[model samples]
Target chain A: MMLANKQVVLKNYVEGYPKESDFELRSSMISSHIPQGSKGLFVKNLYLACDPYMRHKMSHHISNDVPLLASFNPSSVIIGLGVAKVIKSADADFEEGDYIWGMTAWEVYTLILNTNGLFMIKYTDVPLSYYAGILGMPGLAAYIGFNNLCSAKEGDVFYVSYAAGGVGQLVGQFAEMKGCHLVGSASTDEKVHLLKSQLGFDDAFNYKQGNDLARALKRHFLKSIDVYFENVGGNMLDEVLLHMNLCGRIAVSGMISQYNLKKLDGIHNLFCHISKRLRMKGFSEFDFWHKVPEYLEFPIQLIREKKLLFVEHIAEGLAKCCINFCWYLLWAKCWKEDFSSFN
Target chain B: MMLANKQVVLKNYVEGYPKESDFELRSSMISSHIPQGSKGLFVKNLYLACDPYMRHKMSHHISNDVPLLASFNPSSVIIGLGVAKVIKSADADFEEGDYIWGMTAWEVYTLILNTNGLFMIKYTDVPLSYYAGILGMPGLAAYIGFNNLCSAKEGDVFYVSYAAGGVGQLVGQFAEMKGCHLVGSASTDEKVHLLKSQLGFDDAFNYKQGNDLARALKRHFLKSIDVYFENVGGNMLDEVLLHMNLCGRIAVSGMISQYNLKKLDGIHNLFCHISKRLRMKGFSEFDFWHKVPEYLEFPIQLIREKKLLFVEHIAEGLAKCCINFCWYLLWAKCWKEDFSSFN
Candidate 1:
């Protein structure tokens, strides 16, 4: 069967903060039917994750030898993590109507040539959209960043930056459940409320309130942070460095604040490392790939019991992909009730 | 017997760059004889070590809970590591004229009340002043930071900042001896020449030439650094961060650039850690206390063989102590013939 695919394409390599104009939504034709004996799976894309990390891929930024995270080759579809349904498959491992998640483009349909990176969905009990977030790469990162890397102990003073967002919410709740005194920062009052009231954080603050970040950190966490999960780099990281306790661990999951800039902001006051004896480490889901099976059971069970909470913002339609993505780069999420609904 | 002892005392807590007036020279008197049955050792200070780490201890820099590295109690003699000879002793472990190295105040005569931190000077074939740099705290730090922490391989592309100073000089020679491709940075042309000619660094640069540090690093190494020995921790460290290779290791030995400042200079390019899979660890000599005996044999033998070279800077009097200490803070040692006379 022949089908029309609506896709998002990169017009040129992004310069600074990406606008909707950088991405072009174009119509293309594809044959939905797989060739006989071809080991390919034809998928109908459902929920595509609008991750801030995708911003790094939009720019051709790096020294000559350093590898790009994701290279957005012009005229090709912009690919990202997505939850999709296998409509037809000539691959023996996949069956029709089976749900799977992997690198799918921001489009209605995808013909996956190689299933090497794809994961077969075994459970249908949870929401399919969750595979794009809490049960997927972000979930694994949240687990490993706190438990394995941070080595967070009970009674540890834990701090999370970008605390009400995708990974931070899960990290706060999980570390809080582990008997930590959790303090987190968000950009808005509503998100702070969600963090403190709904997400099991001990305390939360709106960083945009125009208070000094270091002073606010000192006020909230009296003894300074023992374990810091650093998702937002730049000034947030700079302030966190000041309050980090001796021998403190910083698990660097993302630098969303630094990623979109033309000239990345400088982190002054790194001198704290000498006196405080801080350990700052950058990590990704690739580091924790082995722990997925072991890490999955606890969060999935907690969610089932309604003991674990998560705030998800979903955008419908592939055409809205560019518009929804622009929000992350601008970092202007108002965190209104409509933007994030907790379950 | 009464003996006159001259000592250098901290006049007041230093504000920014320490001055000669920050330390006052005063005559003190003590019994030249040891007290009967009292556990004390009376020593004549020989070569006192001048190190950059002392800058942190001069002021009240830490929070209440955090431990002070060393507090410079006002009107008291400034204390640091020194090579001394015992003139008298009441302890059964020592007799008259036994050489030792440990913490001794800036004075010609010191009565050591406790010898817990002292190490017996076993061999004296080398210069007695050798204990000040190549065989003391600086040497131990250089050994452990690279061997124990960095796990530096033979062919690794190694970079050292503040490369002509105490620890960096030793680290460069040892790593070069290990057959690593080494590049180093110093603050003067003479120091850069010494790094290339005397210390055996493959290439070296004077950072004070005001070239863009990141570009200079790229030109020298050709590839991103695999191991970074960070002694200077301002913009140079920030620049090194940009050119670090994947799975790069940075041994945070000292931030000499940060210590004396009321506000540490900003490290702007710390954003490079995320993509490079960098591991930056801050360490000190205390971390390698156990490795001293096992590690000492290697470098001491190299020194004996004349294969390992180290530069020594000597300040003659307790009065010259304050003046010489300023060079490390200003980072202005010309590294000319007078600064290092070792062949």
Candidate 2:
């Protein structure tokens, strides 16, 4: 049997900031039936996630350090995390009508040759779209960075950049639960308000409003930052170095601000690392995937009790995902995007 | 009785590279007798240490992160680590003929009001001048950075910058002792030869010979660096980041190259910290002073057994000390200086 599959493919390798024209929406015919003697699953992508790391995949040369994050070939479907339902399964681990989430392509239907990356969606009580953001890779990223890397403690003055973004929003909430003094920085006033009022951030600010990031940080972080969740890097990191308390920890999750630039911004205040006895570590969520079972318990309980809040924007189709992704990179709101309602 | 004390004092706060005229030598009259009812030590200064950190103290504004490292006040006697013989004592802990080493003024005769910082000479078999370099702050700094912070182990690929300097030389030796495959970088061919031939490093390169630091590092570090003992920070650090292997650790002891500049050079390859899952920490020897007793055992045995070697250049008299220090900063040789034979 054959099925018509709609996909968002890379038109060309992006240089600097990406444009919507860099991606193309096309339809192709894919086999709906699983071939005999091959253990594979044919999946119908339900909820696709738009994330910052996907931008790196669009580039021609990706760093060899992250072997799992491979670059996207021209005319190939954009690869990302998505929630999908197994349509036809030859693998014993997955069955028809079962919902799963993992690395998938930006298409209505996907032939998942490697099922090892896929995870069976155990909890159907929560919205399946939630698996694309709050309960998926973004949630896991926040858990590893804040808990495993930063070692956030009570009374710690925690500061996070891109506070309204998928991982940042969750880190701020985790800081609040740990009894830390939480402060978050966003690009817009709306995101700042959302961070403080809805996301449980102690205080939030619009970074674009002030040219002086040092003064802004000094004003909000009266006691100085003890833990910093770094999502955006550049001058922001340089200024944060000056305001960090002695022995501060910075968890480098992503450098969204530098990802699009041909030349990365140079950080000038690294001397603070020596003077302040500071420690900075860079990591990815994939590094701590083994801890997923241990991590799921904490967030799942808080989410059920309404103690945690997540923000997201849902786009309806494969074509809209490309437009929404471009917008997502430009206007870095603290909300994750779920490309749902795919036909 | 009165004594003519010849002292070296700071003329003004230094702007760039320090000039010999920045220090002024003057004669003052001081009582040889310890004042009655005062717990003080009247001592004759024997040896003073010329160190890179003293350049920071010469500046008007120093980072408040290191409270112990305060800036110099104009017209005040330069304070530094020195060895002295007690001429007179008003304290019960010290006697008239005891030999001690601690923070002292750059003068022939000094009245130390606080004797708490002073340490009595325990081992007499070692050269008294050795207390100024190998057995002093630099030695302790190397021990703490390589052993405690870097967690260096056998078969590790260890790299050290400014490997002929006071701290760098010792760190290279420690790395060698730990059975690590050591590679060291120095400024001159002579220093590079000394690092490889005399210091037991597996490989040594003259960084000044090559304009491309990345290529120099790549040529030497074929297996990539597992641990880096960083002394000079600037372009060297930026290049080193590119060649670091997965889970690499950088122990930042100092940034000597940036100390003299009004504006520090910016580091651009920080993204490698994340992709490589690297960890970088900055610290001073003072932070781990409590572990001194435990650290002393390892190096002392090595020195006594002729397993470890130290390098130094001795400059006689207080007046020549100022000239030698100016030269030391410009031509950063791997040798420590002892301003002995003061009159």
lDDT tens digits by residue: candidate 2, B6-49: 99999999879889999999899989877787899999999999
Which residue pairs collide in model 2, if any?
A164-A334, A165-A334, B164-B334
lDDT of 2 by residue, A1-343 (tens): 8999899999999887788899999988998877778898999999999998888778877455577556778888998899999999999998999999998989999988888768888888778988888889899999889877898899999999998888999999989999999999998777787888888988999887767777787788878889999999998999999989989999999899988888899988898888888999999887776776677677777788889988777877789899988887776542322212211
Runs of candidate 1 exceeding 4 Å displacement: A33-38, A62-68, A287-298, A337-340, B31-38, B59-71, B287-291, B337-343
**Runs of candidate 2 exceeding 4 Å displacement:** A332-343, B33-38, B62-65, B332-343
TM-score of 1: 0.92
**lDDT (tens digit, per residue) of candidate 1 on B221-299:** 7877889998988878887888888888888888887777787777767656767767777776765567767766777
Task: Classify candidate 2 by CAPRI docking class.
Answer: high
Output the lDDT of residue B293, model 1: 74
Backbone clash pairs for candidate 1 read none
Q: What is each predicted model's overall lDDT from 0 to 1? A: 0.81, 0.85
Native contacts recovered by model 1 = 0.56
